[model samples]
Target chain A: MSAELRRLLAEVAERESERFARTHPDDDVLLYERAVAPRRALRRTAQASGVAAVAASVALGFVAADAVVTDRRDATPAASPSGTSLTPTGTGWTELPEDSAADAWRVSGRPLDAFFVPEGPDEAVLVGADVTGDALTTCQVLDAFARFQMLADAAEAPLPEAPLSSQRLGGFHGLGDVGVYEAEFTRRAGAAAYLALMVEAAQMCRQAVGGAAVVNVEEDVAFSAVAGGGMRVDISRDGTDPWRLWVHVQQGRMLTVIAEPGGADEVAPVITSYFTAWDR
Target chain B: MSAWHGVLEELIRQRRSALVGYAYLLAGDRPLAEDLVHDAIIRTFSRARRLENVGAAEGYVRRAILTLFLNNRRSRSRALAKQHLLVVPDVAPPDDAAGDHDVVVCALNGLAPRQRACVVLRYFEDLSTAETAERLGLSEGSVKRYVHDAMVHMRGELGDIDPGPEPTPQSVVLVKGGAR
Candidate 1:
């Protein structure tokens, strides 16, 4: 009976296969090209950088708490480079001075000015003020961290065994503004581990930020791993007024960039700049 | 062109239709079957794998398609949870009742995704129960149960169909290689 059933199944499969083949005959060359484009671009970037197969760890000095406070008072409006428009149209984020923390805050409609308090050698808390000079309390920053930790613990499976050190919390710009937080592992956590954590974290953030902030996990948008040694996961929120949570892991460092009402184009360059500086 | 690119182009030009058809049998949707094939191709070629020839590349792509299909099914609930955020809904292709194989296809779709996959791998792909279990990361007992349940359901739908002698099983070549 099983053999007879198998023969019948094979016959149906062959007929349907032939029908499908006749109906959709043309090869989609465009889809193939689009799928491979990112890979080609990554190869070019690696070749141009002359940094292929070179993994170096540069210790970035913990930003002085006083420095963050002083920089806010000295914040200047972003200046576009000559011959190229640096700012994306209709967005507060400017492409110029790609590594400026001040410019990073502009997307959230806040000045770069913020107070940084050192929590440990590898951890710091940032407090940013609004237009009215109202600043987030240290307790509020800790509360957010607690929430993230709680969500991580509640995940179905435990995160990777790699201990996360070098934790830094970016300034809080209220519930409406973008928030940034980053950490580096004491040891190298494999790319797969980081990707898993990114997905779990993205889902957690989606639940934490109620209201139209849905997570998008389509192949092109959700997760992409660079050939050499980097993995990027973008969990985009709803369209037009999109909220993007960009998680990137390179070397042993993991940077989470959350931008309310921003696009990947806006946050991507900033992330590149941050990694580039770290590599140096 | 690079060797991998040459292999990729040749596979697409020669075996793309067959791959799409195989995916269609598993997915029961033409557009999704196309996506599964394209995604499988990209996944195979993106990483640095030593594919000695077009045959090996095709094998890799077939394996990728199976993996992707299963993973997509597993994540369907998560994707549906945020379906409203999608700019365009992913509507399945309309079923054409005019086909001679509609009964079989409909019965196949009636089974759960894993059960359908097991049946396709077992009967359509002509893989042994152990091979099917290995491919799907399932225990052999589980594969048997799924195939058994699926056949029972399919027989009910395809009542009194003529069961001809079993055809010769086609050999499926899967190449093994470590990432470079």
Candidate 2:
């Protein structure tokens, strides 16, 4: 780089450093926080708000373990996922994988490639590593159930008619060719709750206030159980749209977050946190 | 100080703007940048004591912030940007005064996210080839090349150094909203 060019670059960088906050608006802080939240996937526990708590306890079969981690924070050393240890790096946090953490309540560094809910929500947590450590995969699993319930409602359909198991992705423990069906099934697992939601959403989708909206986030995920990572399903829709739907069909873990209209912005980061939790 | 507190205070002192600005650009929005920076700082602090080899916490914080920034938009961030862009014109400009450098930013917002990030990081951040490499987790050579390529594209709207395949766009609006 030329001296002048370098200087130009420096000057601009200095100016932006000075003007960073001004260039973007405040609401975007929510957006960025939502985005960053996922990268860390830091564990959080916010109180479930309003219907979120009620609907969660109902037919949806989801627990509204909503945590308002108002402060963007890394999981405490004590709460860090099993086999994960914290090493103070710069300002915030970084988690290094341990050879092993307590096994009784554990989370794997190996990607959560497959999910099988035999009876579902046993005293055990399924995806605990992403939520609150080796604690209860409870909140995350419930969160998933809630989100899937929304999906089921949107398609105007019911849950899978058949039992699903013994699927692999790229010979790995994951979804295969039979994946799209599974994806469809999972997206709308709580049929009764979804159907009920559909009626309400349908009414809102047409109302003056648009009464209410259902929004969610999707990332690259193999909608197929047989395939591991081929295509991606990316769906990003929130308030700006009276209605928005995102379907992620890529070859990676699936992180779907659902929220009501007014609650969309607030819930977005939580959803992203699920993803970030996994990535870290 | 507890390692956590030490890291947080040190990083807050070192990279308040660099980290925040990098995050803001990655998010393509302002408030988001603060959130991202704040979160990244906290995470960086957690790992602060362990960051042995690095010189300034800024180096580590910048990298974490960039990683967080790049990873934020697998799909959703872009859609939000498009929606926001379409509406900004409808909403009045937040400020009336546009500085010379502001013109450069205006031109930048016109480019794609990665392109804009490349431009901003290269020009605005003035990151060294090595330092930029560290921040983006890219190779120094890659940083050198991206910077060159971004500048070439920028020169057209920035005031003509070379005209390449990418046509000269009529307007490039650099996002200029911030706390200050």
Candidate 3:
């Protein structure tokens, strides 16, 4: 039986090989240029920009978690040198209106508050908050945990052996129904690893969404690096309305902030505000 | 120009079709098989491995292809999610002229990714159980079980069709204590 199966497989393989060779006769120089060259260029760019050094430190497990956390705490107070008020008064941020219960509902009671929102005519509200340690895993496990697990297994990184807890926040986005999630990990190394995994997952998610046969749902994932040391993952499902997802691993905490549809230009301020609040 | 690039070009020029054929056996799709080959090439060349020759390069690419296929079982679930959109009619009688091709391919596809990989490495690639285990990062016992289970499934699918009295190859002799 085994021999027969082998013979059959060999026959099929031969037939398929001939057919594929005949059909795809052209040389794949384009594949090499597209896939291999960009990776090489990216490596050179990383080496030049000093990002490679930070990656090496994280990979070596030599990053000090305490120092990162201390830096964040120190940076927050330094922003307000007088030490009188923690919240920014003239930062173009306004307190939520008391009667605007619906808008408040969009921002209130999340793990974090609406310290930052999109600065445009459309009222973009804060949708997520800072959840640390196990809370981060609990919030994101259903959506991206399998990807994290696969990446960790591939890299041989052992995850913390703690039970993940979950809390589902319910509400509808001003544009459409969008989900906002936030989480922070305890260790900088783990956070850094997860950040890398999230980038890869974003790429895979983009492919999955593009390949999905579902009609009338335009899904996309656009990932890019922020100016500082973090990455932003933008996921758009509704036509022309992108749901922005920001992931920052700083000060020994991994922060993921997701927001509903707003102007793309408004992303930087929100990130800056979140980091400022996180430092405090 | 680079050593890896030269080796990659040579491997593509020489072994691209063979690699695609191997991937097609695992993926059971033409376009996906080609994608797997291309992805495997990128994965192999992205890392600075010491590929001394085209043979060594081919070996690395093959391993990468296998890894990519096994890791991408998530696509199976995505396909299942979209199965609702597919309309199925009544089953037709098996085509006699097509021989056992459909039976074999369908049986191969029905097996779990790892099980199918084990069967391919065992029968198609003619590797020993230990070699299959090493390639798949599984224990020898696990490889034996997967191969055994795969053969049992194939046997059930193929039914009692006699394969004539052809002699088994020497490589098949090494796969002892499993499915024999």
Local distance difference test, per candidate?
A: 0.48, 0.35, 0.50
TM-score, second chain, candidate 2: 0.57
**Fnat for the candidates in order:** 0.24, 0.14, 0.36
**Model 1: how far is A172 from its true place, Å?**
31
lDDT of 3 at B107: 82
Off by over 4 Å in 2: A1-280, B24-28, B48-55, B73-97, B113-145, B160-180
Models ranked on DockQ: 3, 1, 2
Using all chains and alpha carbons, the TM-scores for the candidates as numbered come to 0.47, 0.34, 0.45
lDDT of 2 by residue, B87-150 (tens): 1334434444347546555555566555555555665566555555555555555555555556
lDDT measured at residue A39 in model 1 versus the true structure, 0 to 100: 39
Candidate 2 chain A: worst-modelled 10 consecutive residues by lDDT:
A170-179
Candidate 3: segments with Cα more than 4 A from true spot: A41-52, A55-280, B73-99, B161-180
* Per-residue lDDT of model 1, residues A1-280, tens digit only: 5576567566665655565555555655545644443333222222332221121221111111223222211323233222212222233232223346433444323332233221210111121112110011112222233223322222222234333643434433443343445555564433234434344333333343334234353211222212112323333233344444555554445665555443344455434433332221
Which candidate number maximizes TM-score? 1
- Residue lDDT tens for model 2, A51-140: 332352243321111131111133221234343322232321112222323311122222221222221111111221122221222222
Residue pairs clashing in model 1 are A72-A113
Among incorrect, acceptable, medium and high, the docking class of model 2 is: incorrect
